[model samples]
Target: MATFRAELVIRNASVFYAHRFTRVNLAIRSGKIIGVWEPTVAGPEAEEIFDASGLYCFPGFIDPHVHFGLQLGSENCSDDCATGSTSAVFGGITSVFNFTPVLTGAEDELAALYKEVSQSTERYRTNLFMHLTVAEPKISPKKLVELALRYKFRSIKVFTTYSSSGRMTSDGYLMDLFKATRGTPLVVMVHAENDAMIDFREKKLSSDGPVKASHLPYLRPTISEVEAALRVCLMVSEMGGRLYLAHISSGKTVTELYRHFSALLGKSIFIETCPHYLYFSDAFLKGERAARFTTCPPLRPEEERQELLKHFYAGRIHTIGSDHCPFASWVKEKYEDDYLHMPNGLAGVELGFVLLYNLLKSRENEISVEELARMFSSNVSTAFGMFPQKGSLLPGADADITLFDPNAEWKVTLDTLHGRNDYDPYEGLKMKGKVDSTIIGGKFVVRNKQWVSTRVS
Candidate 1:
């Protein structure tokens, strides 16, 4: 009688599934999950065994939106893919979806894409996926379609605001994009905010005094997000294509979606919210450190934040992304007087797992460990078309897994975190949970909260 052997076996892990966690042992072979057994099952011999008795094992987290190594305005983000993905793996993320430079219809498009892919392979440690960011005017629809179909890029992201970068894709151009992706599995992601409304408010508000952080929500009002959301949702429904709203920050936007949720359910409209929107309010922008909290579609009032969380717990929110675009402290320092000049992103990927865990713990009745797993991993993978390959722990799935200790305690500080960025927005915040280990493709990236294979040095 021949006996089967696993390459690696993990014992006594609380594996997350559907809406519950079950204690199980996992067997891995050649970078695939070969078996899922009851905790007491010990049928196979393995080359290596890891005991994870007190830990919760989740599918490796997949962040759907991250801007690693991308240049924003005059400066680049502090962390490139290698450094940024290192931080991500420390927080249990094993895969990420980032953007490439806007497709400019010039230069060989395929060549540019190959270069981007090569650069990613060289720079990122985690499994990296890319979305082509194309502006309305600069893109050639046929070329875009060719690229998407050929490379399986699977998603095209267009901003409804940020006209300064010529990224504003108007209704007409958006229709064209939808038309291009029709009858395909490809999706269109939108950064929805009314450009005209934001420009008007910023102009009116800055005229009086230096644009302060407190003025962010006012400059890009909830109405702006709601209006743009309504438009994009309608376009997606009318065009019969998928649409994803990125970094949704307003209860108003949620309310609008809720009104039409039933009709849009099978229509493929997904909503993603960020941790900052869930935890902090616009008041975080009140003091001298306002620049630190500045993000596009800026933080809303406390009441709105609560409402958004309610929607999240009710299963209305599709996924939670970090929108992790980090810059050095000096870049944030450059915009002391005016909010508009402040870099429009924050770093949170390394803190997202714990921060969200604490939030769900406080509201246990509304969310469960399994649901949190879906939001952080499975849902993102399904949306971006990386489902069973990257987000599942079932047999035959890729051996990407995260071991977490719900009872462990940790602090958010520069010394404790691994990203290249110099600032920690979550500084001084105490978390009740910690990442115990992270595995990517059966290889240990983090073990016992210490770096293993992913460390560059």
Candidate 2:
């Protein structure tokens, strides 16, 4: 496998740039993109070859935030590396940053989980990376950095919302964490919704009787997100720690990022938003649809959605994440009246690229597919310090590439999709452009717009 050469080659493809899509031919050698050269430079001794038939060549997308540690015992979420990577490949993603927290109740079990991953590297399809949420017991930020400087996790997650002792860390503790991890090149991903504010709002909502649709946005007000964002940004700024505001849904929070942004070496602030925030607003959840659209950092009004898109167009937002939590939609059926009880998070991993693809094309001939690549693949890799090697088509880079057909048409249906979650928020939505094929480390894991998941030496 180490000496493999050009197992598959696609010529005449529209190469995707961070902001536009263009034409190019990609050559592979031993699972690395040896060159992006002309067809005349293509070597005939390659194991296999194909004329892309005019498809879009994209560096495989990276989903910067995902939770694979979620467990339901025997009914555990069906997205382990095998299925998770299969789904990612379907969306043209060759790398994933799976988020794991020190398990809430079982502090001693952290080592076991770590061992499981360490022992099962080949069981996964794509090149998987991870971020461990630092726990006070085993992973205080300082110790976490030692683990990182030794073991090297790409990032660490911190929760500011949940009140449970194991979930959310105190602000002072968080500040110490930033200071401790400073200069380690560890990326701190924050779930920035103020716990105290949410507690106050929850009490108020409980006193207000049956939670109605009107209380959806009221319960988790924008103030909670804004205040948390401000505080976290201030902490990072003061201590000079690299921070990525994870799953930023509010336009108000994202709008202030630049004003709040300061870098020790221009590597301090990164702002990421989810598709749910960009596509569906609070308005989409009114009436019976409320349960369907539930997600943390509650979705805002349609106007805010428009504003968020504007932020992307203006380059204020750095990356887009699915934040693809997959609690069954029926688990939310009880929230028919009380929006407070409705489950948070909607599934969109499978639709991450499609939705963004649609948004890029709709901008009145403005943003091109190349820029889309930058925002999605290139920018995320750059933000997390994994670029050039994992996020480009340049020579010696991992041959992680996705080919999309800009004119490719596909209808997303529950039957054709694969996720442990039974429902899709983007269900019934027809989308344009899709991954025609996906290559992971020079392996054709997906071909002709379908997943060909298998063991690759």
Whose lDDT is greatest here?
A: 1
Every model's TM-score: 0.95, 0.90
lDDT of 2 at 127: 78
lDDT (C-alpha) at residue 168 in model 1: 75
Alpha-carbon local distance difference test for all models: 0.82, 0.73
Which pairs, if any, clash in model 1? none
Least well predicted 10-residue stretch by lDDT in candidate 1 = 137-146
- lDDT agreement of model 1 with the native: 0.82
State the lDDT of candidate 2 residue by residue for 239-280, as single tens digits. Answer: 767888888887877766655563432358788898889888
What is the alpha-carbon lDDT for the whole of candidate 2?
0.73
Q: Residue 310: error of model 2 in Å? A: 0.9
Model 1 C-alpha lDDT per residue in residues 1-457, reported as the tens digit of each score: 1257999889887887443688878889898988887766555899999999889999889888898886876878888888889889999998888987776564376567758676656577688788877776455665577677777787988899988667777778888778778777788899999999988887788788888767787888898899898888888777767888999997778988879755774248888999999889998888777778888888999999989988877777778889999877778768777667677789988888788889889889988777888888878877777778778888888898999999998778899998988887889988999999999889898999999884422
Which residue runs of candidate 2 sit more than 4 Å off their true CA positions? 1-5, 17-22, 40-44, 72-81, 103-110, 119-123, 138-140, 210-214, 262-266, 335-342, 455-457
The residue ranges of model 1 lying beyond 4 angstroms of the native Cα positions read: 137-142, 206-209, 455-457
